[model samples]
Target: MAAETSDQYETLQIQYPPSHRRGPLPLPPVSRWALGSVLAVGTGGFLVLGAALAALVTLYVQGQAELREARTELLAAGAPLLPPNSPRSPGETPAAAQRRKDQLGRWLQGLALGWRYHQGSIYFFSSERKRWDDAQLACRASHAHLTSITSAEEQEYLARESRGGTYWIGLVATGPGGSWHWVDGSSYSSAQSFWAAGQPDNSDHGEWGRESCAQIHPVGNSLWNDHNCNFTFFWICKRDLSGP
Candidate 1:
């Protein structure tokens, strides 16, 4: 009877693998408060990042607006516009500013009339011809003097502007032995002078030292030539904007 009972009990018991549990497995206990905390932290981080970006954009826009206002103020102050790499204009007293404006207007008008401005001097080319003395008089009447060429650049410009015509300048042989000088009382320097080949041949060319005036000759490669002062020719005048 005992043997039969043990066999019956063993038949009634059943075995299953650990992974084959019938009902859903129990989950670990989770806190609702912790989940809410995590969500709040994440939301706050996103808000901070968005606020930072907005602040940066606002700063950039304000900076640009300030830069524009500064430029406008500078322009209103009568400051000249310069290149980015150029030096700023120096400050000037009210008197100095007025003086500069007075001179600048005249130079600008001369520029409008096709005159060339350089180093505070405005050069004008005459359409008519006149003797050297008469040309000097005309220039004085116009508040100017006969053009005095100081550098090779000036000579080249005058040559180009002359359009292959003769033009009288301010240089003359004023000294006893044909020493050249400029009309502004500046000594004529050979180093700065541009003379044509075999020029100023005064008496040697039968002028009897009468070729006291200098003229820009279109011939002989467009260089200076000593001509008789009485000869009528187109001339150039220079008005200095630099005050005494």
Candidate 2:
């Protein structure tokens, strides 16, 4: 009976497979090392990608700052930077330049005041009253100067267009008893003068001889008068379309 039991045990041992000798199957040593290597390679690649993204972000920020500084400098130099598609050729056609000028003049006139066009020039009338100095400043802000009358014909035309309203002109005395000149630095000539009779008396009864600024008074055929520079009145702004 002992020999029979020993023979049965040997048969059972022979029938068991070599793989089932252990409790569970285990990975080869090479495969475990390869898996760790792959994880390390992936971590290194992620770090490289993160560094590249940071560099790109810094470059973008610096580029924007440079663009802003360039624009500021251009504005300071009075050289307006137009869009890429704008007329940039140095030898622009006269018709094209005139069209651009007219378009810009129309846009400016439409912004704050109504305008009248005559002889390649645009005249804008102020909607609100302002002092002579304020009016001149406003005109300059609009890329214009206060109206400078050179002829009786021109003065008559302005008076007609303005509908007989009291308005300031560009004529102002440079100093006490000084010569009169237009805002454009042109000397006011007696040949083009349109003063009203007994006007520019330099009355000191109210504000002294400070009445040095000229105005196109509505009374007595729309003639001009030298009034106080501080007096508030409507004004005219004129811009030449042919000007650069």
Candidate 3:
């Protein structure tokens, strides 16, 4: 009985290998809850990173659009990057705000040339020729009048620009036979006289009986001669507005 029992015990021990003998596993105890917590945290971090990237992309697109719009507006106004007297408001992006300010600055710079301000009368010299009456009528139509030489400087300017052409002036004779007067009714009291030798003779048959017009010649000096009103010459027209 003892031998049989020993053999049975040995067989039972052989069947259950020592390595397979069950007890506590050969690893340290692990908390399932802690492991799950770690996994959750890693997943949460990945999601957060993805969301942040998405937000950044959206913001970048919006910024680019706003910049494009600002550029277009500036170009349309023929304005520089900035303008004057521009105000900044809340919620404006940095680029958009800067663009508006630049446009304002440009406007200020052009104020002197009537770009953003009202300029006074402007004057121009016409190279076209017309009769005395026709010239006067043209000036009236253009909201201007024939220039009246009020000073020596003015006469000199006209003389230089006219280049010796017999230009019409605001002077005419009003007498029945030989009386002459300026359009402003001023008598011929200029200290500076620019007459050719043996002028005002009224000798020729060409309006000699009724010579009543002023002619300026480009004789390198601001000299003028009185002639008949019917003579045609290129005239200058002065406007009432200022130009650059």
Give the residue spans of candidate 3 off by over 4 A. 1-122, 184-193, 206-209, 239-244
Tens-digit lDDT string for candidate 2 (3-84): 2222322322111115558577685567868889999999999999999999888765654454445445544555434543
- Name the better of 1 and 3 by lDDT: 1
The weakest ten consecutive residues by lDDT in model 3 span 8-17
User: What TM-score against the true fold does each predicted structure earn?
Assistant: 0.56, 0.56, 0.43
Q: Itemize residue pairs with steric clashes in candidate 1.
A: none
lDDT score, residue 119, model 2?
Answer: 54
Candidate 1: C-alpha lDDT: 0.69
Candidate 2 local Cα displacement, residue 141, angstroms:
0.6
| Clash counts for the predictions, in order | 0, 0, 20
Candidate 1 per-residue lDDT, tens place, 96-187, comes to 56554554455445555656555446678889878888999998876678888888887888888788887889988877788888886556
Where model 1 places Cα greater than 4 Å from the true spot, the runs are: 1-94, 118-120, 203-209, 240-244
Write one digit per residue (lDDT tens) for candidate 3, span 100-195: 565443333322222211122223455666666677777666555666665676666667666656577766656566555555334565455555
Candidate 3 is scored at a TM of: 0.43
Q: Cα lDDT for residue 30, model 1? A: 73
lDDT of 1 at 63: 46
- For model 1, how big is the CA root-mean-square deviation? 38.6
lDDT on C-alpha atoms for all candidate structures: 0.69, 0.69, 0.53
Worst 10 residues of 1 by lDDT: 8-17
Which candidate leads the pack in TM-score? 1
